[model samples]
Target: MALAEPFEIARGVQTESETVIVELTHEGMTGVGAAAPSAHYGETTATVEAVLPRLFEVLPEDPHEIDAAHTAMDRVVNDNPAAKAAVDIAMHDLVAKLHNLPLYRYLGLDATETPTSSFTVGLAETGEMARKAEAAVEAGYEILKVKLGTDRDVEIIETLAETVPDARLRVDANEAWTPKEAIRTCRALDGLVEFVEQPVPAEHPTGMARVTEQSPLPIAADESLVAPADVPAVAEIADVANVKLMKCGGIRPAIATFHAARAHGLETMLGCMIESNASIAAGVQLAPLLDYADLDGSLLLADGADPFDGPPVPALDPTGVVGTGARRN
Candidate 1:
């Protein structure tokens, strides 16, 4: 049986979390895993609840058979993203445990290297944004992802650029701007921001194409991409694609989307849905192949039990284990 547990986080905004837990019982051995959905993607408590019952029906008894797991996931996709992610991660965890392999190893990810993760500075006033950026920099995050798209977008970018002048910076609008505004904003912040994500709505790719063609900084699509089906359009308009397991509905689709993005000459980023370590761990399996990463959702949680959190926040080692490196200052 698998269950979803909800947690609350105080980040750029106060948000509720619903993480799914999968329980596998075979020959008296049990294993557990978790998944979380993105609220920005229209996932909610009720959405997760609606899909749980159906997911349990086809749950596989064996973890080694990726085919069976894929079939189950295909069925679960009928549900919302949160539900699908919960089910998919739980199954992956079970299979990895059954095989006595780390989840990342099971997925064939480079385990001995720790990829640099971008710490996000959520939407705030210019001064506050600068302070947050400074704090993240002081904490040793080499990359800083800023949340923009609000009315104060320009001021926020300028403040961050000044505060963490040397840090690699990326911005995510969460689809908060119109095409014209996106062009104006990206051009305005060109030198300061490394890239801007999903400035316009996902439904209007042509508009984004226009913005991408005219903008100074590169653009990455976040909400605008769902499955491999949407990748072609996004590739045409955006320079990068942000792949979230929750948004892609699960790892299967996320991998497919990754390959699709690569084939289209677009950069790839592994993004998270403000999730816990369980979900982040699943994402970590695919991190080695990504050009950019935003899997720091676990860092934003005020209270949560994460196996990855050691004496100091562990840097991802090449082996994909959490504790393989010296703690960063």
Candidate 2:
């Protein structure tokens, strides 16, 4: 039997309130994965819940048959990203368990002892953001992603730069600006930030391209590159593409999107919605091939949720460097 459930994470302002958990059982081995729906993309808990029944109807008795599983998932991509991701992850987990290997190994990543991940400093008062940046740096985070697009964006970045002079900084506007505003903001924060992500809406790829060509810092596409179809357009305008399991629909499409980004010379960033470790662990499988990773959602949660409940797997160290182990840096 396949069991699916829901969860919520309280991320202020960017409150990610919905998640879907799926467990697939076959031959007494259970495979599990979690997914979250983004309201920004017209997905919700209800949408994922509505699709779970249909997914169960098509799941085959043999979980090891990857082709059959993929076919079943392809049939459900139209419903919602969260639902699709949940089902896809469950299948991947099943396959990994069948081989007695970690999920990252199945995805072709070398297991490392630790991989350093960035800590996010959400939108807040300039002083508050600066304090958070200082605290995060003190806590051993080498990279910081700042949420922007507010009236005080300049102040936020400026204060953060002042607080953490040596830390690498990036900003995500979530497509909250007009082309003119995006250009202006990018120019203003040019030297202060390493990269500015999805400043303009996805529909304005040409404008983003124009911004990328003129801006001092690199530009990354987040909401702009949701599928393989979006790759060409986003590549033309951006230097990087942020691939989220939720937004890309699932693991297969996320991999497809990564290849598409590589084909276009656009760097790939393996990102995630505000989700639990279950989803983040599943996403770590694609990390080795990515240029930047923002899979620290699990760390950001106030309550701990361990996706991999068994032995602790080696991951990247806090310095953004991969640790020595069976995993590669």
Cα-based lDDT at residue 80, candidate 2: 74
Model 1, residue 273: distance off in Å is: 1.3
Off by over 4 Å in 2: 1-16, 111-115, 304-329
For model 1, residues 1-329, the per-residue Cα lDDT tens digits are 12122322222454455566555566654544455755667777676776677776776766555457667757655647667666666666666666666666777776455557888877766797798789888989879888886788888887778778889888888778889999999989988878998888888888989999999999999878887798888888999999988887677678889899999999998888666666666776666678888888777765544433321232443342431111112
What stretches of model 1 exceed 4 Å from their correct place?
1-12, 111-114, 304-314, 318-329
RMSD of each: 4.9, 5.7
User: Top lDDT: which candidate number?
Assistant: 2
Model 2 CA lDDT for position 325: 12
Put down candidate 2 lDDT per residue, 1-329, tens digits, no spaces.
Answer: 11121212112364334567788887777777776888777888888888788877887777666557667766765647778788788787777777677666666765454344567777766787788789878877879888887887888788888879999899988777877888889899978888988888778777888888888889999878887788988888899999998887777788888899999999988877777656666766666667788876656554433333222222343222221111201
122, model 2: CA deviation in Å?
0.7
